[model samples]
Target chain A: MSLAVQPIDDSETINPEAVRRDFPIFSGSTQPRRFHYLDHAATTPKPSAVINSISDCYAQCYAPIHRGLYPMAEQATSNYEHARRTLQHFIGAASPDELVFTRSATEAINMVASGWLKPRLERGDVVWVSRMEHHSNYLPWQLVCQEQQAQLRFIELTEDGQLDLDGTPELFAERTKFIAITHVSNVLGTENPVATLCTTAREYGIPVLVDAAQSVSHIELDVAEMCCDFLAFSAHKMFGPTGIGLLYGRQERLAEMAPLQVGGGMVDSVGDGMEESRWAAIPARFEAGSPDMPGAVGFAAAADYLSSLGHERVHRHIVSLTRLAAQRLMRIDGIRLLPHAGLPASGIVSFTHHNMHPHDMAQIAGEAGVAIRAGHHCAQPLLRRLGLTATARASFSVYNDESDIDALIDAIISAQRVFCE
Target chain B: MIAQDLYKETLLEHYRHPKNRCDGPIQDADAVERGANPRCGDEIEIGIFLQDENIRHVQFRGRGCAICIASASMLTEAVAGLSVAGTRILCEQMHDWFGDIEPAAGALLPNGLQALAAVRQHPARQKCVLLSWEALADAIDKAGRE
Candidate 1:
């Protein structure tokens, strides 16, 4: 199969107003004012194209895949495989067979830890992760290490909240068998240099898993260039539906791994005895059962929607909004933005007020029809490392404009006035 | 007016000048307990000095939202002079105050707790208003066991 890159028009400009119209949730509401949605890091609102694709699948071509010889079943199977290929190209994977569909990014990480790495690891082996990883990326390694009597190590963050690259070499000594880290932090908005980290881990014969849950929507990913052995991400974080996630692994590593779930669809041949049974092929072996067909259709639609917009343009738009929000939010008195080093924040800005609690701030923001997230953001260890219990976060997406940032700033000021006075 | 209605003047006053916000655990308290809202990381520790089956003194130390801190500050004042049985009744009343049904006739709330009625409008924050009272109940339970 030819893996050719699609041609994109570099000079195309993105009109966020036009893009906002593609999402019905923004306009169908009866509210007097527009809702300022700044929580894209949690989940994105679905576009009309993705929604229509899902409904069309159920209405026109609803059937079980890979089983029936009838026309409907064949259409469903083709659509599902096409969705896989679309995602494969989206992430620049070597082949569609490298991608395995899981329930979510959390389940994808769990599969790698239990099925791929657990059987190969020995007692006293070490798994290294960064301090800024979301709990979904951190807890799987922690649990597997505990169960296997292996050690779990953390690559600490510097004072500016980037990965402490200077202190990382000491944590990657001989016993380090696997390295799991996030490509971008959900809370601190720090984008780690995964390519550099992968190159270093490859030198030590260590397999690395990149959690791209926060990066796939904003940054273009190429697994070959990244040189990481495995990668995981969820579709919901992007513009697709929930309950669908993707895991990409190097062909050689995936070939050696066992299936996490053994079921009807995953069996190549079956007999009464276990010795007579063999698992299915690469992607099918991991999929295990009837797949989420509608989700796959929606996922492909989301991929097409983003591709049409061009990821380069998307990156520029989100980064510009993040920088603007950070600058304006910093001007507010008693509001402190979490420090980042040289790398700019990728569509997220987390902060705290010296006088008001984050929950109160978020509540006030919500009252003004602005949606933001407040709490530990499932990165309690990272917050504890920073000596903070909670922080308010405003994240951006392609549909978010400058007015959203203004609303967030106004809400913060309102909270300050209500509490500090 | 709307802002003051949410963060009422009485509530803000109590938050600014908390009655029994202390530096450490009460040195001579008979019972101590801690409560935390894991979702938001709001935590509070309550200590009670019980003498002659009455709450002689109550002190709290922790970090939390304004609603939680104010509720704790007001809680310390409300339960300080009450008998152990009366404290238990107040705990029951606090739980009832959060319910959809109103308190029965003649079931009066303590004076300072009225400010927290505003919390009912923000259902997401009811937990914040109840954190300190929950800790007080836990301390009373520990004292009973002792």
Candidate 2:
């Protein structure tokens, strides 16, 4: 199940300016600020095509799917299911039936924790999660572990914030039944060695879940290649609409799992007796209500947009920008990039100012129309480990340019003048 | 321009040299309350020493943004001689002051709380300005119970 890597013509180059033009938010009457959107890790703005697709679904092909018999209904159903197939190919899943539509990456994790892990776990079982996981990935497992009286263990991070893979042998002792880790640290931007981790977990017969919310857009993901049993991500993070997320599980694993929700579209039949209800097959069983058809259409459009750009091009562009940004930002007085010695981090550059609070820095930057995120970034534990209360993060996407980084640096300098000088 | 207005010279002065920022909890404090802005990890622990319903001494201990720390410092100085009821009124007044300021108009707030007026422009940061006041309110409630 290899991912379709579009051949990159050496003659061609990615024009971020051209990419930026595709997004209406960058050049519209209703545009917010100078729109140096450095907070791509938070949510990327929708491109015109994705936005148009969503509007087209609602306007031309609007109807309740999976139940209605009208032409509009059939069109809606086809469009919605077509998005599933697009996503299935996007992540290199074995089949569309293995994909479940969730509200967000947070809900996708909750679905796996509650539906799959809870029923099989015993009191003394252990679930190993990495310290760098976002709260979305951490809290669900914590809740499930607490409910099932299972121990939740954290794989310690190295001094540079990368996962300590060397320490894996001791951590994967017999009781470790499950492993949940992030493909990339949202705070540090360190891409974990997930393939190796998956391979290790497989040897121990431990099921692994990859939280790819941060990596789906930035990295070319192939769930089959990673060999992880489950993966979760959101569309909004990748320039699609909100309220649509993907939960990819291996077919065998999904078949063994019970549904997180049981209602309308998810039930094959509700028996006269309360205990005799039969669940629908794989993906449908997990998606209980009327799906976000328009959102699905938008998500597919986003996938198509990315595919057209080619992940190789996106990766190269971001990596180059990240390295340049990191080098430039590090030169500024009082700026400290989170230490990393392994493979260079992704497009995210999280740092703190010595003389100012991150919120203050962000506020100053915001006034200058440079949008960067400040705070723990829903990864409080990681910040605590880094000896920081909060940090201002400037994350990049395909749309971001070198000028955005310059604006961020200029904003930081200006903030220092106001706060420190 | 807006950023400078938010972190005024006076506010930074207070933040750098906070008034009544104690090393430990106030000795034999009547009330102690800890307030945190969970989103940004800003924390403030306030201690109040009350004598006959009057705030005899108020001290804050913790770290946060300039707005939060400055607000706490200014709040302690403002309410040092006020009764618990007076402090409550001041809290309400502060809330109204921020609430009343127009987003576009950079109006002057009352003397002690003028630094926080800029928070009204940045709605997301309003919590940083109010963290100390919330802790003070909690301290007052705990003091009243005692």
Alpha-carbon runs more than 4 Å astray in model 2: A1-12, A341-344, B23-30, B50-53, B95-110, B144-146
Candidate 1, residue A23: Cα displacement in angstroms equals 0.7
Q: Best-fitting candidate, measured by DockQ?
A: 2
Interface RMSD of every predicted model, in angstroms? 1.7, 1.6
Best by TM-score: 1
**TM-scores of all predicted structures:** 0.94, 0.93
Superposed by TM-score, candidate 1 places the C-alpha of residue B27 at a distance from the truth, in angstroms, of 3.6
Over A41-105, each residue of candidate 1 has an lDDT whose tens digit, in order, gives: 99999999899999999999999998989999999999999889988988888899999999999
DockQ values, each candidate: 0.62, 0.64
Provide fnat values for all models in the order shown: 0.61, 0.69
Tell me the deviation in Å of residue A178 in model 2.
Answer: 0.5
lDDT score of residue B127 within candidate 2: 83
> Backbone clashes per model, in order?
0, 0
